[model samples]
Target chain A: MSEAPAVRLVEVHKAYRRGAQRVPVLAGITFDIAAGEFLALMGPSGSGKSTLLNLIAGIDQADSGDVIVAGENLARLPERLLADWRATHVGFIFQFYNLMPVLTAYENVQLPLLLTDLPRRERRAHVEHALSLVGLADRMSHYPNELSGGQQQRVAIARALITDPPLIVADEPTGDLDRESAADVLHMMQALNRELGKTIIMVTHDQRAADHAHSIMRLDKGVLWSNPDDAAAVQPAGQG
Target chain B: MRAVPLAYSLRNLWTRRLTTVLTAGGMALVVFVFAAVLMLDQGLKDTLVATGAVDNAVLIRRGSGTEIQSGIERAQIGIVEAQPQVALGAGGTALASREVVVLIGLAKRGAPDSVANVVVRGVGAVGLSLRPQLRITEGREFRPGSDEIIVAHNIRRRFEGADLGQTLSFGGRSWRIVGLFDAGGSGFDSEVWGDADQFMQAFRRNGYSALVVKLNDPEAFDAFLLGIESDPRLTVEAKREPVFYADQSQAMSTFLTVLGLALSIIFSVGAVIGAMITMYAAVAARVGEIGTLRALGFRAGGVLLAFLLESLLLSLVGAAVGLAAASLLQTYTVSTMNFQSFSELAFGFRLTTAIVLKTLAFSLVMGLAGGLLPALRAARMNIVEALRAA
Candidate 1:
């Protein structure tokens, strides 16, 4: 694990336009996750956890302040460069698996590598290793619809790991999965962080899901708290 | 930037097989109409152009545009045939045919009540020799000054009282149909031939319609044409035989081309709209897929190209189908009134390589027009909003 943080947010702020209204999602957010840390963000609905994760992944821009990920300030990069930067630095996992229904498991995993200059034979080898790491080596030819939800998420994990990116951001990765499937996915994610020393940031509302990470942060009304009890102290009784 | 694979576009189109087929079918129908029109125009021009030999010169009245409207007196025919450039035949006679062209109304083979105008050509002794491609397909040639007529192969099958051994009552006289001659798909295949003197007397005509002269050297045509037009005693003009026949088809060919193209334009609009609708639907259905692709680091240009490629492939499939159907039209012959000659001319549809290239290019244009807007819409979608569509 490195002493320097893998991701740093310096007073980052973000907002969305709803007609003429400027609705702020995240305000004055500042945080850091060490190189080998597994941090989970817990928040209520509409609390900007996903927005913060998007900022760190370089998929969205900050309205003000800076978002630095993988030693580069993401807020300063242009959209074209940001996409390329994401391809090399950040892997994303969505709640719904987000696998292309038309492509098989191997092809879905091989999608990111297509952006690189990797040869076909080498791409096949990387895809094979990634799918095997997720324990779906035999299901490489199966499409998303043919696989169970847990299996599909495993395929997405293989896709995320195919490029061997430094940081992985998952937004409610196990939100749609059953208990057993969620446990399996969380265990896989933990192994990726511990064994490969990769930085991981997860956004989830479930405390049990957040428990898999090294530390947890709670967000409420565009503000962050290191302790869940500190955030709960400000909430009215029975409001959650 | 890495482009989406061609297989991806192909597979996506295959996934929506019904929409792809329906859209492509519309484009194919438009292509069929476009190609068929070109073939009809080519067929009309080819039939008339094949009627005359390039080495032969045709002499008609100075102001006449067609043989049917031309009048050349017997004295003028002799003066025109006596030119030094006229080719010599076997017995040292000038190779010229003083022909009388007249139109006669005859009943069609199946409908006796339906009468159509048919051309009757009275050729001199060397007329058959001049047209080397003319072959007596069924019987022998007509005897001179015997009221015996040789019906063209196309004329015999199309008109009544024009078959072999049949007698046609016209020109206040009975004429015997002695033979059926095929003119190798030339305009001559629509005319009946008899001796010039007998036709002149039977039709009460004082002069010939035109004089066809074979030149000794085809290269001497320019000087020969100059001499004939400059002659003070002659009221005739000379043109290369092939040029004369080709001019005969110009008006009718232009009419068919204009009409066919107008129809194709109207139909292509509908097909292009159909393709647009199909592509729009594809984009709407695949919004989530597009977002996922973007998230995987594909540029907007890649997404746009993929959709456009799918549309182009669909249109090409339609073009191939339409062209196959249009090619079959080559086997059947059609007859219509020639605007220039005012007589029914039979010609089959002719397909050429130029027409194939034109049709494919036209289909590609329709594809590009229909695919552009939808592809732009797909490419311009907001990534976060698009992912939420899933």
Candidate 2:
């Protein structure tokens, strides 16, 4: 609690264009994610939970207001610098795993390291370390399609962790898995948070999936409720 | 920034083997034609230029662009030989030859009905000394003042009645072929040679086409040229033989080069279009991949460079294949009509370092031109929107 938060957002807003019409997605949002804390963002469909995660990951820019990640003001940073900042500071996990089908699991995990100035031998050691952490070290040469859904997600998680970034933002980390596979992914993510002490902010629609996090925040109709206790936990308040 | 690993692009092309081969094949065809055209142009120029001896000078009538159109009287020949710059032979005779060039119709050996113009040069033993590259391959030289001619070794294959010991009639006289000579693939290899005085009497001509003379000193060409041009008694022009042959080849070579380039330019458009369509499809299919790459911190410039390199690899593969195919033509020869002399000229495709470099530059341009827009689109894609697409 004494340390500065790993992520801070000041009145963040974003919108989309629906055929020349402005459709608001996130409106005036503010939040802070403490270092080494696992935070989950819960929202109904079309609630802009994924967009908020994108803003935190620096993959998309906010329409208005400031987004600060790992002590860097992202909204003020130009796009050219943001990519370098993201490479050094944050990692991204997607809903479908998004592993390149053409690359082996080892190659997919090595993609981020390719942007670094590390020597090839050092990169190989780092890639092996990350892949082992995900327990897919033996599947290093298998492509995405050749692995099961849970295994593919593990490969993607290995890719996200390969750069050893302090912050990890995962969008629907278990969305494409079956119940068993989803449990496996959730358990691995919890281990990543508790054992490795990573700061994680994940977007999910399933409360059971959100329960793995130490803290839960909710979004609805472009608004944020920072405390899960503010509304009854069993009610599923924002379900469409 | 470090280059994206070549293996990445190589693997992508391999993953889409069908499109890769099709696009690269199209590029290869264009580059093939481009290289072949350059080779043809070089070959024609080389053959013509080889006929000229650097230390020798050629004299033609003023305003006559070629020897075929020039005329020098006996008095003019005597005046040119008397110049001190003219080299003396072993017997103290001036190393100069009064030559007459005339074109005679000859039937092609394969297609007897198809006729081509062949040059017939009337020369003496002095003319033989002027061009040391000329060698009698078979039989003997034509005797002076006799109805005798010698066919060039190459000319004998293409024309009728051009073999050793054969007879041909033209210009109100019949001349027997006494020998066959080789001119080391020079333009002279396409001509027939006989006695100049006998040729003049047979054709009823009073003037020679040109006077070819060797310089007494290597650097005496300037004096030789000045002596001929400064003479008030003669209205004639003289030039070093290399310059003369180069001038003769300029117009025909230029026309061929321009025509070949225009065709290649037109062909390259279709090739570039094929590459564009393939690259656009690649971008479309890899939308999710591109988004992931952007999310992984590859700058837009990096993405653009990666795609451009992919396209360039495809085109270069094609160019290599095309150049290999073009080099095969270097072994065989083709005959074309030299517009300067109105005679058939035989030459082989000649590959030079300059042509190779030019073809490579040309293929790279096609790749850059084709891949640029598609690469821009890939670079500019919104990461959120791209990742959102299925």
Name the candidate that leads on lDDT: 1
Check candidate 2 and list the clashing pairs.
Answer: none
Weakest ten-residue segment in model 2 chain A by summed lDDT: A231-240
State the lDDT of candidate 1 residue by residue for A84-183, as single tens digits.
8888888889999888787889888998898999999999999999999999999999989999999999999989888999999999999999999999
For candidate 1, write residues B218-272 as lDDT tens digits: 9989989888988899999899998999999999888999999999999999999
Can you tell me which runs of candidate 1 are displaced by over 4 Å?
A1-4, A228-240
All candidates: interface RMSD: 1.2, 1.4
> Which window of ten consecutive residues has the lowest lDDT sum in model 1 chain A?
A231-240
lDDT string, candidate 2, B262-352, tens digits: 9999999999999999999999999998898888888888888989988999899889999999999999898889998888888889999
Per-residue error at B112 for model 2, in Å?
Answer: 2.1
CA lDDT of each prediction against the hidden true structure: 0.89, 0.88
Name model 2 segments beyond 4 Å from true: A226-240
